[model samples]
Target: MKQIVTHADPDLDAIVSAWIAQDFLFQAHASEVLFVSRKVPEKFMQSADCLVDVGNRYEPENYRFDHKPPAFENRNSTCATRLIWEYLLDIGVAVRHLEGLVEITYQGDTHRNSEALKQSRIDGPHAKLKQLKAEYKDPTEIYQQMAFWLRSYTKNL
Candidate 1:
């Protein structure tokens, strides 16, 4: 199985991004897209092709931002959500329907620069994970109501 992996205790961005990636993979990869939200088990990382996130604690080349220029890192302090959305857009996924979701959550990234987010207070409680549960009304319902908002260019990613 191919893996769409996120950092340990994945936050909102990581979880949402992983779900989006899974949807995109369904359009391409034939096998199941395993959403690895914690440190990837060795079996998956070693046996499967892995796509990882900014907080990826895994040491692997599939990492998307390992060699980002220092300036870029400074400007965009967090990864996962923003990176995933941009990657989806770049790869031609239908994420034109989800841009707003990406931006609203990015604010949490700035908060991450200074504080330690916790589940009760996690690392990126916004960027990092605290628990796994549904936080939206319903994705299908959301898409129906806000597809236009996401498609519009309020600001650049």
Candidate 2:
């Protein structure tokens, strides 16, 4: 089974990146998602099939996607979600249905002040994410719920 690792108490980017990996990258294959600390443990670093948003590394060929400093300092407008999404497209995966999802994720990660973002902050996915964070202490539960929501969301987009 493929093992995907991301940060615990995952934010939008981390959850969405992992979701993309599970739903697209590993489609038709069994996979497990693990949530770790911001400083990913060396165990996961060595054993995880994919590391997203928390590895501090951005080597797509290696399936390690992160936009943190030291490795991706110039990727100010991109986040882990965008990297994984682009990787899917590069690998010939169909993700045209996800363009809006990816764009909103990028906007949120980069803190772009747009009317849509502002409205989302008020009562959209962003608001739902915040509500989920406040309600659930378990990261896995949060990811599961968000993954379900994202699956439904993309079908509509």
Best by TM-score: 2
Show the lowest summed lDDT stretch of 10 residues, model 2.
69-78
Model 1 CA RMSD to the hidden true structure, in angstroms: 8.8
RMSD of each: 8.8, 1.3
Q: Candidate 1 — worst ten consecutive residues by lDDT sum?
A: 123-132
Question: Using alpha carbons, what is the TM-score of model 2?
Answer: 0.94
For model 2, residues 1-157, the per-residue Cα lDDT tens digits are: 9999999878888889999999898898899899998998899999999998888898999999999886687656589999999999998999878877777778998877678777767876788788898999999988888888888867877
Question: What is the lDDT for 111 in model 1?
Answer: 55
Cα-based lDDT at residue 39, candidate 2 = 94
Candidate 1, residues 1-157: lDDT per residue as tens digits?
4555545434455555555555553446643334443545666555655444533333333434211234154534655656656766776766676655555556555454322233213422232222222334433333322322322422343
Task: Kindly provide the TM-score of model 1 when superposed on the true structure, using C-alpha atoms.
Answer: 0.50
Total clashes, candidate 1?
11
What lDDT is reached at residue 145 by model 1?
26
**lDDT for each of the candidates?**
0.45, 0.87
Query: Model 1: residues >4 Å from true position, as ranges?
Result: 28-48, 54-72, 75-78, 112-157
TM-score on alpha carbons, each prediction: 0.50, 0.94
